[model samples]
Target: MPRNSDLTPDKALAVKWINDNVAQLSRDHMTIWNLHEPSWREYKSSAWYVERLRAEGFDVEAGSGEMPTAFAAVWSNGDGPTIGGYAEYDAVPGASQDPVPRRQPRVGVNRHAAGHTDPHSALGMGSFTGFLAAKHVMERHGIKGRLKFFGEPAEKMCGSKPVHAAKGYYNDLDAAISFHPHSFPRLANSCFWDTHSAPYWSRIYTFECDNPETWQNAGAVTGVAHGHSAARAPGAIDAVCLMYTSSKYMKESMLPHHGSWSLNEFILHAGQAAADNIAPGLAQIQYSLRAPTLDMCARVFEVLDRNAEHCAAMTHSKVTANWITRTRAGLANHAMAEVTWRNFEAIGAPQWDEKARSFAREIQASLDIPPMEDPFTPEIQHLTAPWDGEKAFREQLPSWQTNLAADDYVDYTWHAPTVRLYVGRPTLRAPNPGYRYPEWTRHAMGGVPACIDPMWLTAGKVIATTILDLLSDGVSLDKAKSEFRERTGGGIGGTSWIAPLLPADFAPPVHYRWPEYVTTVRGQEWTIPTAAP
Candidate 1:
C-alpha cells in the first residue's frame, strides 16, 4: 500500500453511494444474466450495458473493435491519468440452467442453451459498477483523470480484446484493471494474482472437398471401364473426422505435458451435406490451445497444421487455418496488486445475511445434503492468499512461470500495467458424507442477488478505491508504471516484450457457424431448442 494516506473523503462517499444503490445494481445484473447470449452474439446484452453506461453520462462507442457487440464507454474530468476497466458479457454455449435449487433448464426453451456458468453476470456487474462508482466520485470531487469501461463481448471465444489492443484502443491508458469470480481456495475476496496465466490461441481450419474425381478414379473415368459409377471419394466430413482423430492420436507426442498445454477441437458446420453419394464440399474445425509459453504453442500448431494437410489429402480436400483469437501471456505487476489487496482488507468479506443462508440451505436440501447452520463456508468472507495454487504451479513448472490458464483478459497485461482482482461469488456447498453441490445449485446461487451482491459490492469497492488511488495519488500510478517498465524492459516496444498474436489485418471469425439463438415466426428459442412445443 502507498504511504498510508488518510482515506480520501470523495472515495468514501463513492463506496457509500455504490452500497446504497446495490439494489438497482442487482436488478441490472439479473437482467444481463437472463439474456444469457453466448460468444459473439450478445447483442441484447451488449446494448443493455451500452445504454446503461450512456444514461450515466458516459460517451459510448457502441462498436469499437470491428466487432458488432464490442464497445467502449469513456468518462473523463480534465484527464490527469487515463485508467481502464472492461466487462465480459458473453455466456458459454450449452450450459443452460435457471436460478433454482433443483435441476432446471431455460423455461420454454433449451435445456442446453448458453448460460453464464462462469457467472459472468456478476463478473460484468462488478466491473461496470466500479466504472460507475469511480465516475461518480471523480465527478463529485472534480478528480482530474480519464476512465473507460470496455463492453467486451465474446470472451468465451477469447474474441474482441486482442482486436482492440492491435487497433490501439488501450494505448493511451496508464493501466487496465479487471476482476473475476474465482472459486479457487484462498483466492476468493483477495486482490492477488501475480503468477497468472499464459496465451491461448484459437483458430479455425476449414476443409473443402472440391474435387471428387481425383480420389475415386484419378486413374479411371466416369463413363469408362468402371461402368459410369465412380468409387466414392471421402468428403469434407471424412476430412474433419480424420483431422480430429489424428490430433487426438498425436496429442501425447505433441507436448511433453510439463507446462499444462492443451488443444481442443470443435467441428463447425458451414455447408450442406451432399446426397446421392456426393462428397461434401465444405467443413470446418476449430482448435483452441493453451500453453505456458508461446514457443510451446507454436510447436503444437505446426503439428496441427501438418495433420490438417494430411487429413485433407487423405479425404481429397483442401484446408486452411483461419486465425480467430490469440492472446499473450500475462505480465505481472506487484505494485498494482498490493494497492488492490490493501483495499480488500479494508472492505473485508461480503456479509452473507441469514436470508442468503436459508436460500443456500434450501438448495442443499433439495440435493439431499443435510443442511447445517452454515452451508456456505464463512472463511470465504475473509481475505486469504492462494497458497496451494501458487505452490502447485511452481512445482509443476519453472518458478518463473507467468501464465497457467486461458483468458483473453490477459491481453491487457501485454499492452499496459494490468491487474486481475479475484473475489468469490456465492457457491453452493455440500457437507461431509455428501457429494459436491450440483452445477445448477451453484448457478442458482449466482443468479440470486443475496448471494452475488456481496461480491459485486466488495469488488466495486476495490475497483473504486484503486481507481481513486490512481487518480488521487500519482506515486501509486508511478509505482505501477515503474514495475511495468522494468517488467517489459521499456514497455510495448521493449526488447523482451511480446507483440499481439492476431495480426492487425486479421479477420474475426464472426461468419463461422457459432451457436446462437434462432428466432422465427413461431417466436424465439435457443439454437432451435430440441424440445417439443
Candidate 2:
C-alpha cells in the first residue's frame, strides 16, 4: 500500500479539485426547483465525477442499469476481492441556499434555505478519496484486486431502491462503506448509529373529502346540522386535523424503540374563498413511519392503518394509504465496525470522560428516559458505549411490538456487509441562524467555493487512506462482516459520543408566511386567484 505520507498528498489535491470545480458543479446541477432530478442534476454530476476519475486512470462506466445517473467506475491491479465505495449528490427542496449578489426571480418558486446539509456533496469527495487510496494501495503492494466507486443519486426519498431493484448493485459487492456528515464525530457503537442508521419504511396517506357547501351552510342549518348532520358532513379540514392528531396519539401509545412517525405535507382544496365560505373538497396528507426492522415497520404500519381507519370513520372521509418507499434493514457489520473503532481510538478522537458520562446519565434520569429503549434518539450524544447494550435491551418494552398481517410483513435481511459513517458539518448545526435569505445565497455560493471544496478534499484523503488500509492490510471482508454482525447484532448497540448541541439562541424568525396565490398571463384561461396578489 502507498505510504501514509503519499496518501496524505492527495488530500490537498482533492480539496483543490473540489474548490476549483464546485461552482460549475453546483450550476450544472441547478434546477428550477433546486431539488435533484435523477436524470438531470444527479446524472450530470455523476458524469462529471466519472470524467475526473478517468483522468486519474480509473476505468469509468456511466449510466448503470435503467438509472441514467447511476454509474460504476473500477480500478484494479490484477484480481482480488472488490470493495465498494458509494457516493450520492442529490439535494433537498426548500433547503438553505447560498446567496449571490444578483437577485434572480423565482422559477418554479421552490427554493431551499439550506442546501446539501445531508452531506451528499461530501460523498463525492469521500468516494473519490477512497478510490484513489485503493488505487495507491494496489500499486504499492502489488495487490491484485479491484476497487469500485458507485455513484448513487436521489437518496433524498430513498431513491436508491429502484436502482437497486433494477441493477442489483449490492448483489455482487463483498462489502460497502459510505458516510454522512452530521454535527459531530461518532463511532459505530454510538446510539446515533443505532437509531438513525437502521432500515425504514415510509407510508403516505391521502384523504379526500367532497364537501363544497358544508362550511357555507354550516350555520344556516342550525341545531339539526350541529350534531347528527355535522357528523355526516365530510369536513376536509376536520379530517386532516383529526388524522394528524390521531397519528400523534397512536405514536405515543405505541412507544416504539426503533420507529418514528411524522406528518409532512397537507394540501387543502378550498380554492380562493373567505374562511367562512371556504369548504374544502379535498385534503391530502403525507405520513412517514420508520423502524429498524421491516417487521417492526410493518407492525407500525398496522397501527397506522388502524389509526387511519379510525380517523376516516370519525371524520366521514375516504382515505387511501400507500407505501411510497422502503429501505433495507441497516447492516452493522461487526468486523468493519471494530476496525473503525480501532482507527478512531488510534486517532485519539474525543473520548467521553467520566464526568461527561455522569452528566449524560443524569440527563437520562431527569427525563425519566429509560436507558435507550428505542435504538434511535434525536439526542446524538451518549450513543457509544459497549456496556450500554444490556441496559438498552432491558429497556425494550413489549407494548412496542404490534401484531402484523401477512401482507404487511417484510424480511429484515441485508445482502452484504455495509458500514455507514457520519461526519459533522456547519449547515447541520444551524440551518437558519439569522442569515438573511440573500445572505444565505451568498454563503452557499461563496462557501462552496471556499470551505466545502477544501473540506471535501480533506474528507477524500481520509476515506481514501482508510480504503487502502482495508484493501491491503486492514482485514478480510468475511472476518470484518462476521465480527460486525456479532457485535451490533440487530441493534445500534450503545451511546457515548454526542453531536454538538444546536446553539440555544434562535434567529429572528422570518415572518413571511407562504402566500397562497395563482397567477395567469395573457394567454392563460380565466381562473379565480387563490390568494391576495
Candidate 3:
C-alpha cells in the first residue's frame, strides 16, 4: 500500500486546499442540513449546489435527465480521462432533530419533518470538498483531466443514479468514485471488496376512481332522490388499503425468507373528501424492493403487480404503475478498490478530539448510561482492510449471498471503473452487548460540527488524494479499467454484461405526490400540521 509519503506535489496540494477551506465546507453542510429537503423535492438543496458549482467554473446543466432536482456539472483541462463524482442532498421524513444532545426537533418545523439521518449533508459536502480541492490542484499544477460532479437527489429511495445511468450521463466517464458515511461497523473505513450492494427496484402504483357512479348498482326511480338511496362505490382510499394489506400478506411469498432482501412500502398520497360520502379521486402507493439478484427483484415485483390488480378491481378503481428507479446489482472492481484503499490508508481514519468525545458522553448520559473515557465506536477512529471488512460483513449473510443491502452507487459500476469508499461517521459505543442506541443519538451527532466534521474531513482528504492519484498514475488507472472490462465481459456490452434496467427514454416519476414541506396559510411546514391537536 502507498504511504502518505508517496503523495506527489499535486496530490499534496489537493489535501492542503481541503484543509484550508474546512470552515466553508462545514457551513455548506449545515446549510443543506437546515434545508432538510426530501426526495423529489430537493428544490433548495439542488439549487444551492447548482449555483455553487457554476461559480466554481463548471458548466452545469440544471435538472439533468429530466429530473428537476438533478444536475450534471463538468470542468475539463483539454482532453483527458473524465473522472466522475457526485453528491446527494435529499433528507428523510421524520428524522428532524436539533443539533443538541437531547431529543429536540429542528425549530419552525413539525416534530416529524424531514432531517438528515445518514446525513447526506456531510455525504454531499464531503465529495464536493474533494472535487473542489482536486480542481484547485489541477489548475495550479496544470494537471490534464476532466472532472464531472453530479447533483443526485432522492437517493433515500435509491433514486436518480439509475436514471442518470440510463440517460447516458455516465457513458463518457473513464472512472468514477462513490462515497458514503459508514452506517455499519463492519464496513467502516474500507472499500468494498468481493461483496458489494444488491439490486433495488422501486415503482409507484396510482389508483384513480374516475367514475364511482358506474358501479354495479342502479338508482331507484323515486320522485325524491334521497342521498342515502344510491349505492356508493368504494373509492381510491379502499383500493390503496387493500393494496397495502394484500402486499403485506404476500410479502412472505414474494421470495424465500433466506437471503438479505427487503420489501418496503410508502403511501405517497391517499385523497379523501370532507363532509360527504363521495369516493376519493386518487391514491398512490410506492413499493421498493431490494434483493441479491435481478431475478429476485423481478419475482417480487410480479407478485406486487398481481396484488395491485386484484385490489384495484375490488375497489372500482384503475391502477397505473410508474417506474421510479431500477438498478442492477453491483459489479466488483478489485483494482479500483485497491487504489481507493491505498489512498485511505495514507490518509488514515478520522480522529475525534476531546471536544467530540465530550459531546458523545453527553449523549450517553442523556440515555442514562455511564459515559466511558472513550464513548465512540472503535472503528470510527481506525482503519479496516477491505478483505477484513468483507469478512465481517459476510458473517451475518448466507454463504451464497454475494451482496448485502442496496445503494444507487451500484448503478455506476456497470458504466465505468468505480469505487465505493466508506469513512466512519460518529457512532456511540453500545452500553452492553446487543444494546442499541436511540435513533435521536445518531441524528444529533450528525448535526454536531465537532462530531461529524472529522469523518467528512477524512473522507475529503482520501477522495482528493485518490482522484489526484488516478489522474497522474496511468498504470493505476489502466489496471482499474482492465479489471472493469474483465468483470463486465469487455465493458458495458459484453456477453456477461447487464444493460441498464431503465431505457434511455424512461421518464422519472417526479410527478408523484411525494412527501415534502409546503407553505400555506400557516406558513412553511411539513404537509402535516405542526400545532398540537
- The TM-score leader among the candidates is 3
Ranking by TM-score: 3, 1, 2
Q: Which run of 10 residues does model 2 get worst, by summed lDDT?
A: 403-412
**Stretch of 10 with least lDDT, candidate 3:** 216-225
Best lDDT among the predictions, by candidate number = 3
lDDT of each: 0.80, 0.46, 0.89
Residue-by-residue lDDT tens digits, candidate 3, 42-157: 99999999999999999999999999999999999777789999999999999989999888888888888899999898999889998999899888888899999999999998
Which runs of model 2 end up more than 4 angstroms from their true locations? 1-78, 99-114, 136-143, 161-167, 185-196, 208-241, 256-283, 290-296, 310-318, 338-413, 426-449, 484-533
RMSD (CA, Å), candidate 3 to true, equals 1.6
Model 1 residue 442 lDDT score: 73
Q: Rank the candidates by lDDT, best first.
A: 3, 1, 2
Model 3 segments more than 4 A misplaced: 1-4, 221-223
Once fitted onto the true fold, the runs of candidate 1 whose alpha carbons sit more than 4 angstroms away are: 1-6, 218-229, 274-276, 385-400, 433-435, 530-533
- As a whole number from 0 to 100, the lDDT of residue 206 in candidate 1 is 93
Give the better candidate number (2 or 3) by TM-score. 3
| Shift of residue 429 alpha carbon in model 1, Å | 3.2
